[model samples]
Target: MTPWILLPRRVVSFRMPILRQAFALQALHELGRLAPDLARVRAQRSLEASLQSLREACLTTLGMELDTLTLFDARSVVRLFAHAEQARILAHLMDERARTLAEHGDYVGALSDTVYAGQLLACSRQRFGVQRDAGAAEALERELPKPGP
Candidate 1:
């Protein structure tokens, strides 16, 4: 007979932090879409707080513990799904952050954030077969500063 395996309490604790981070970031993204100039300072503060919580969760939980581990492993399938969803949430958040930064005249920061978001989307495609629009990333990439002579 097969045995029933249970997840560790520590791993279970990871869910709420992940859910909170996702919700917070999603709200920031929605706000940016609705009003770019308005509420940006609040959005920035919210993003920073959520990211701090996310950082702690990643350290304590299994989040990003094994970037070397591929998504094909059956044991990590649940984590893979959870992380994929987080990636989507984070990509949107970073995209909105980039827009907000650009609006504030922080071009370099905007480019950096935009690039990171693109990388996350690329990873999402590899892990979860979720291919977001590449055109958006490319459009932002074009606006990045060119190499100087």
Candidate 2:
């Protein structure tokens, strides 16, 4: 009698999980710059580890579970993968955060977050638009930062 072993087949994903996590991490780092206290707590953790960190920090930093965090915790959602629509959503959230910060006497923090939120808006526009005409492109070029010679 011959014994046979069967191998299971599974479809491979087009994108790698690590790449997804890297992108998420980059987004989180960028957004974290807006929420300094939150950023400081999450600085050392990787995106893969962040959900768990959030769970842990829930009690320690936030005084609630990660799942319990709400719009008041908008910064918590900044790590999500975003396209044009999500970028718009994040930009609005940041705008709201800036207002919140300004009301709380964090004027510098509000300004920094507002700038980052504007960057997010630019990201959204560039993602879904047609190529700019020469004049529009020139205007954008004048406004956008250019590398120093």
- lDDT by residue (45-88, candidate 2, tens digit) is 44334335434433342233444433333433333334333344
Write the residue-wise lDDT of candidate 1 on 42-142 in tens digits.
35555464344433333233344322322234333333544444554445555655766676677997897687766767766666454433433443234
What residue runs in model 1 are displaced by over 4 Å at the alpha carbon?
Answer: 1-83, 131-149
Q: What are the lDDT scores of the predictions, listed in order?
A: 0.48, 0.44
Candidate 2: C-alpha RMSD to true structure equals: 15.7
Worst 10 residues of 2 by lDDT: 2-11
Per-residue error for 76 in candidate 2, Å, reads 17
Global local distance difference test of model 1: 0.48
Instruction: Look at candidate 2 and tell me the lDDT of residue 128.
Output: 39
Model 1 Cα RMSD, 1 decimal: 12.0
